[model samples]
Target: MSTPLDATAIETIQGFDAEKRYKHLVKEVVANRKIWILIDEHGCVMLNTDDEDCVPVWPNKEFAEAWATGEWDNCKAESISLNKWHSRWTHGLEDDELAIVVFPIQDQEGLVIYPDELDYELKNQAKKQR
Candidate 1:
């Protein structure tokens, strides 16, 4: 995020298809070394897709902040370093059977994946970056 995010970039990124967004998510998350989530005083927010409990994540703060409206109006964007995600989130989400929705927009559900699955992809992406 060295460059300031603009409305045009936000629109373009949000317009990308889920697969494209998923690729962007991996690259950006690895490059930035953090994952963004919406949080309130209690904790991170969760969205439900049928019976599944899913945590929504974004590539950066701006994107995450965009969703902090409606029911999540009180929420704020929170960043989790990749280290913390690996050390705590993976196991905790696995135990809870919660899935992650990567870079989701208001209308579309992004890639819904398990924490270990995302962990694997992110690790692979980071290795490639190195």
Candidate 2:
């Protein structure tokens, strides 16, 4: 059975008039720089990095639902646009690392994590391994 749309999903759909509008936003943001929005099988959202595996991104709810059933482990996927995602969560990030923000339905305050100190820490780890 298809999952019912929640408040966030409804707001996201209404925010963009059509799928084309959503695609246009994605294209516009991606034109400036590569952007990735990471969303798990649940509603949790994060900012994906270049080093991570490719995650599916759907322009609208219909597409997300279709993919969610057969391919995405039967879990509903909710995503925010790159700009909206950045605006909502980027303020919490430190200058040195990639940020992962988790938005849970019950909680008003989202959790933010900087996985590593970006290039500096990763490079140091690499050097130590060599």
Candidate 2, position 22, lDDT:
36
Model 2 Cα lDDT, one tens digit per residue, 8-41 = 8655644554333434324433443223333555
CA lDDT scores, all candidates in order: 0.89, 0.39
Candidate 1 on 1-130: residue-level lDDT in tens?
Answer: 4344799999999999998998998888889899899999999899888768999988889989989999889999999999999999999999999999888888888888889889999999999988
Candidate 2: list runs displaced more than 4 Å.
Answer: 1-51, 71-73, 79-83, 89-130
How far residue 5's Cα lies from its native spot in candidate 2, in Å, is 15
Error of 2 at 37 (Å): 7.9
The TM-scores of all predictions, comma-separated, are 0.94, 0.30
Against the true structure, candidate 1 reaches a TM-score of 0.94
Stretches > 4 Å off in candidate 1: none
Q: Which ten residues in a row have the lowest lDDT in candidate 1?
A: 1-10
